[model samples]
Target: MPRLKAEDAERREAAGHGPDFLEALARGLAVLQAFGPERRQMTLAETARVVDLPRATVRRALHTLVTLGHVESDGRLFRLTPRVLRLASGYLGANGLSAILQPRCERLSAEVGAPCSAAVLDGGDIVFIAYGQPARLLNLTTMVGLRLPAFCTALGRVLLAGLPEAEMDAVLAQHPPFAVTPQTELDPLRIRKRIAKARSDGFALVDQEAEQGFRSLAVPLRRHDGRVVAALNIGMHSERGTATVLRDSYLPLLRAQATDLAPQLL
Candidate 1:
């Protein structure tokens, strides 16, 4: 296949662009995002299938990304290069939210001897921007930049709860709940109720939904204007604590941290 020239690619991508929107850039980002933990590397055909774009289109995007050092291709398969992390690092640096929340998450993790994280809702997923883990080794590991479904995590629930009712309904409709585990809630009505409860109660507690044997408690990190910009959560094994124990013991701590950080989020 011939490499697509910049102008040619832009002309081809014009079909999806509006007056201000850059369709070519969006396609490039979509192609970059198609590679994930499950898909460390993929062939051109596989990439086309995953992104639902024509093989030629995906090839051009991959070729352009490779030229920019954001992706690497061995002529058959492609993978994201370390240079892509620059995008994440740049966002963290400019946004400053991760830097601000990192120390707080570490303190919370140390206090409870568990893993803690802060995440923001992006589309139907929650992206971890900051994370902390205790000194001791544990079976599970969570980290920054991890993305998980919104309907199944405490962090995600709290973040979603912060959205307006109509917006929340649309989001739920767009991404219907799926069962991550047997304990995961698949009912949209029940999930909405849980989100509503989080909005009213100022906290969310989820048990073994995202991962079996893991229970998490979360609270919304709000700005001075009372707008929730992120969610804070801590997770532990279900064997270590029941739902009531997690709620009673950890909810206050989470809420306290959220409150303390609210003023800084602005």
Candidate 2:
């Protein structure tokens, strides 16, 4: 197959997609993501290099972003402002799934005596929107806006398993491999095999990949139309339960809660 030119990809993507869907939104998001924890303030040249866009394009995007209040800049440096939070907040406020699933997640956590969370796929990471824990001690310290690599987390795998094969391939291709932990799978073939297993099993069990002692299991939450909107997960210490324990004991509870909450998602 031939690679698509930027203009061709944009045309194909826009033909049937929403009016708001466009390559410009993606490029703008890339610009915003260029400013992260380590590179909070970036010069125009640095932003262009990081986002892999032309300096002129990056500058115009930055100017537009600043005008929209999503970014702020001094004469020489640009950084994301708190106004960016409104974009995320708007998503949470608009999605009824978080509110509908929070109670079920809490109940599941109480029943399993572990921490339960709900996350939606945001680009290549899973974003936590709602969570409940037995105690704050066992928590992963993840907040509503925290992002984690999709390939290493159970919540991520479950969500990824629901995506179209081509889309999943494109996403994984971007970060072919990165070692988040010793147990992380960096091999594409192995990752594909695991995703296939998750697709067949209807759940994903990630063992100590995100952190040394952390293990998590997740099931996809589907909307009324049967589209997967998010994932629900229960995470615990490695010592707390074996992988077998997670599969045999906790998975059923998680599946039950997901089934119960599915009706509320749409």
Candidate 3:
């Protein structure tokens, strides 16, 4: 449809390309994002609908991307080329967090016989950046790119503990906590106390708080300056054990690993 181009043209014309803004580039990137992990390939109509762009605009963007070796297309289907991975690889390489933490997470997962991860705060949520797991069957599982509300999760609490008082309040205010489970805590005062404990105690553990039948323990991963940057967590089914058991048994090991890895992250 010609409408997508017209829509984009309207945005650019309104902005007058002010102060380094590039509407066409933004639209092309949006087209690329329409292909996610679950959506590996799309027909023209699928891409147009997913990106909410007009079909003609999507077609032009796809053609430009294909020529630049960022996208590939058959006569009827379009998909991202492997070249797109360069974007993620550059992030992983530049940060070096995944490279340094992933192997440690694997070892920790094997030792604890549970899933393990490292996550960073994003607004009112925590996003998993590195993940590892054992073979135990779980009712719920977390993976890289999984996002969970910060207040109800051990990972989130430990990360929130890193922030100063005003900043932490602002972070929490970004989203009103809603129930994922009956056990999820939404009270600001109670959450503030949990974060305080996580800061003084250096770890947080919760059972059936984020989700029913699941438990997690987390420790802060800090830089050499001792500023927390991410959280390291281990999660298991609630049937496995209680929060106290993990705190006494697995937490020492988790903290040790986090401490050992902190300097490497610098």
Index of the highest-lDDT prediction:
1
What would the per-residue lDDT of candidate 3 be over residues 1-266, giving only the tens digit for each residue? 59966775677678786545676788899999888668989999999999898899899999999999999988899999889878866876777777888788888888888888999898999988888888664536447666788999999999999999899989888777788899988788888898899999999988798989999999999999988888999887878777787778788888888879888876
* Candidate with better lDDT, 1 vs 2: 1
Candidate 2 residue 262 C-alpha distance from true site, Å: 1.9
lDDT of 3: 0.86
What stretches of model 1 exceed 4 Å from their correct place? 1-17, 138-142
Query: How would you encode candidate 2's per-residue C-alpha lDDT over 36-61 as one tens digit per residue?
Result: 77898999999999999889889889
Task: Please list the residue runs of candidate 3 whose C-alpha ends up more than 4 Å from where it truly belongs after superposition.
Answer: 1-18, 21-84, 135-142
Looking at model 2, the pairs that clash are none
Error of 1 at 112 (Å): 1.2
The residue-by-residue lDDT of candidate 1 on 1-266, one tens digit each, is: 24555555566567655356666788888999999999999999999999998999899999999999999988888999999989998988887789999888888888889888899999899999999888895636557889999988999898999999899888889998888899999988899999999889988889999999999989999999999999999888888978999889888888788778887997
> TM-score for model 2?
0.79
Per-candidate local distance difference test = 0.88, 0.86, 0.86
Task: Rank the models by TM-score, top first.
Answer: 1, 2, 3
lDDT of 2: 0.86
RMSD of each: 3.8, 4.9, 5.0
